[model samples]
Target: MATRFSSFVRCILYIYSFSTFLCLHAHEARETTESYHLHHTHTVQVSSLIPSSTCTASTKGPKREASLTVIHKYGPCFQSNKDQLLVLNHTELLLQDQSRVNSIHSMFSNNSDGNKLRESQATTISAKSGLPIGDGNYVVTVSLGTPKTNQTLAFDTGSDLTWAQCKPCAGQCYKQVDPIFDPSKSTSYTNISCPTPLCTQLTSTTGSPRQCSNSKCVYRVDYGDGSFTTGYFSKERLTIISDAVDNFIFGCGQDNEGLFNGIAGLLGLGRGQVSLVKQTAQKYSQFFSYCLPSTTSSTGYLTLGKDSEISSSLKFTPMLTLSQRQSFYGLNLTGISVGGQRLSIPTSVFSTAGTIIDSGTVITRLPPTAYNALRTTFRQMMRNYPMISSSDPLFDTCYDLSKSQSVSIPNISFFFGGGVSLDLNKVGILYVLGQTEACLAFAGNTDPRNITIFGNEQQKGLEVVYDVVGERIGFRPGGCS
Candidate 1:
């Protein structure tokens, strides 16, 4: 099965006896919510997604762009029919909050420590429980383990770390990704001592249990949706299709549910603390690119060898490089237009200098102002159609289901760096109710699921290329190979 990178948002509705109720089109606040799982089918192929090329060096300049190339790298998903990778179904991560300091202290304090000291420390831990928002520091990913024979796994650019399930897990495990991390066999596997920086920070809010120090390098991670994954850490063998003799730092996860129990581990694409990309690039060259399809993104190319595919016209947007954090790619968005009509929104969406271009996130979320601009423009263009009263539950732009072709919304386009524009068509009409042509707006929200997601729906029919070497992204109008 494909890694379940996308997460599901549950829905709850409130019904009243009245035939027409004053409907409140409840919308979930848009934020960079974490993912639940990674889904990949065994049939996914890299060649189908990327253009093949021989590795070539770029012309060195003050700032030279690398040649874009896709190398031939294959893994189990390519050869087998069974789902071989375990993935986390959903992740619940929050910026550490000072209020959680007490909790952190209790979680980190050794019970063997004096009770009075532990209580005092608990107060301190709670105060520093959550990390500051947008800081992009102090994050973690707990994987299940490694490939027994040989397995190829996808590395996610939007993730924080890459790890797999380890053997000898205390709880449940998945069948895919051979040979779980048997902590007993791995000589390098060692628990994070309670006083160590990693252990102190990671388990501070949860209160470090004495059991963790007993010699196992085990860890636990909880997500926002209530699912959790636990496993041990170890120095395992990592093989890159590009090269085999060398190895990189990887993890072995275990005892995870949803999607977390299947695959060897994750390939974190997020910027920070020596990710898989960084580690791998160090061995070869600091260069890689991803060509994501405009259609269903069942496949894409991750190039580490060369940059031969570099388009001369590729727009280079200025990036705000964050220190001590995973540096992310940003866009200098100029404006968004619908059917050639420009909206009156600020360029801050593009100019904020930190608009994270993360694939890990399913939605292409814009700031409040950016969102309003798009909504207003869409509503204006859609004025020709009769507006439905908020009382209707079927659609925010409700029309009698009997009415044929009553609503028409134009295709919206987002123009970004380097003359690149991502144009989304009726797909932006993006959501419909259960096969019927009803707007998604009418979907009542009781539990605030992810409503503002600029899901794959927005990305359909647009070719996107993430150039890691150039530190920029490129786009082409048509579904160019």
Candidate 2:
């Protein structure tokens, strides 16, 4: 009787243990399945031209995968000339991929967790277009000489400085844009004196600064867009709104017609002695803003001052300084997410600390894998919208003009230094449109030139503040408009 009782008790204990083991296994399986579903939803299949390494999890700059061949067919100043000449020369440059520049993973994992705002009397400005012209930030009209010369010309930030195609040019010169800077004749034009602060930092991708023994101030600048501007950095009257500030100038290259206009020069923005922002910030508090209008609008505003309209929700983030040779702000990335789903991209994408917060571009470009992952989620969210197609070269995706669907996409956010987060509407984060059926255009194609790019379209309705003195920036969703 005793043996039978002991055996019965053992059997009961064994059954209880088995039941608990099964429950534990079932719970683990459910957790894993949920995780897999979340990851797969955000993965996109991108063109294989871009490398997989570009999407790694480091804060390094992006790598250029291929060369871009841009043949300028028409520009506003020279479109009527009908010249097929390659005015803007395209070169292969190493650019920082935007994806790798900001990592979402690190943003959440790091210490201090980016929650504090630096105590400073912060100023704000609207972002502007750095191309075509100043976008109204610093409108500098150039001529052969001082006010007496009156050879009025336009100023462009896309170009490095203000310069005309010079006479007896030493390099390639296209015939369509004809007005050239005459170094020999402009009486007011004198060589930027050597040993001056500007001369030490003068440089470009071409070679060392030409000895300024003559009257022409000379320097060189390589652009993020693969265009190189060679010119002199000199003192000129720069009109920033109402103030006539003496600023360093860029006398651009004759070959620049490949990418530049017949305009007298470029407006420097690099950290060198001749940069427009560098020179002007000395007196104006180093605060500026550009209000880029919607793609449908024809005009915008570029204001310089402490703009107080920046969202109170904004947190100032740290800025990473790149090599002196390069321009544009750089930042470290942690990772990115859609809805709440995290992506499983490689860590190489954000390894280099070389991403730019540029206002000139129209869309955000990323590594093949990273771009695919985000794009996949974006397409899914936008799938319900009606499709429309147009011949407009500017349109990237097709959408139905009449189909009005309430936007239901989630807000996309970016995590950067100082615990700052930048959020945007779901549709605003993508470069897709549903204008028509069967006609799909990828407006912002990921090029080999830049691994990642954050363009103007993503900046719509956002207030971007540049506090140069503070070495920090604050971005607010929606515009100062």
Best TM-score goes to which candidate?
2
Q: After superposition on all CA atoms, what RMSD does each candidate show versus the true structure? A: 19.5, 14.1
Off by over 4 Å in 1: 1-154, 174-221, 257-264, 293-298, 322-327, 348-354, 380-409, 417-420, 424-433, 437-457, 460-463, 467-469, 477-481
lDDT of 2 by residue, 1-481 (tens): 9999999999999999999999989999998876754543323222211122111221111121110111112222222224543222111000222222222112222324222222232233212112222211112232343432322233222223444555566766544233555656544545567756556545332234464645544665444334445555455444443355544354545455333333333444433334456556656466655434322212233445564454475567765443322234555555566655656765456443234565543345555566567657655656776644443444444444243333344345665656676665332543432222222212333432232445555555565666666777777654432
State, as a TM-score between 0 and 1, how close model 2 is to the true structure. Answer: 0.56
In candidate 1 the C-alpha lDDT for residue 288 amounts to 51
> What does the lDDT come to for candidate 2?
0.43
The lDDT for every candidate, in the order shown, is: 0.39, 0.43
Candidate 1 all-Cα RMSD: 19.5
lDDT of 1 at 77: 21
Q: Number of the top candidate by lDDT?
A: 2
Task: List where candidate 2 sits over 4 angstroms from the true fold.
Answer: 1-145, 148-189, 193-209, 212-217, 220-233, 252-255, 261-265, 307-313, 323-326, 339-354, 385-410, 425-427, 430-451
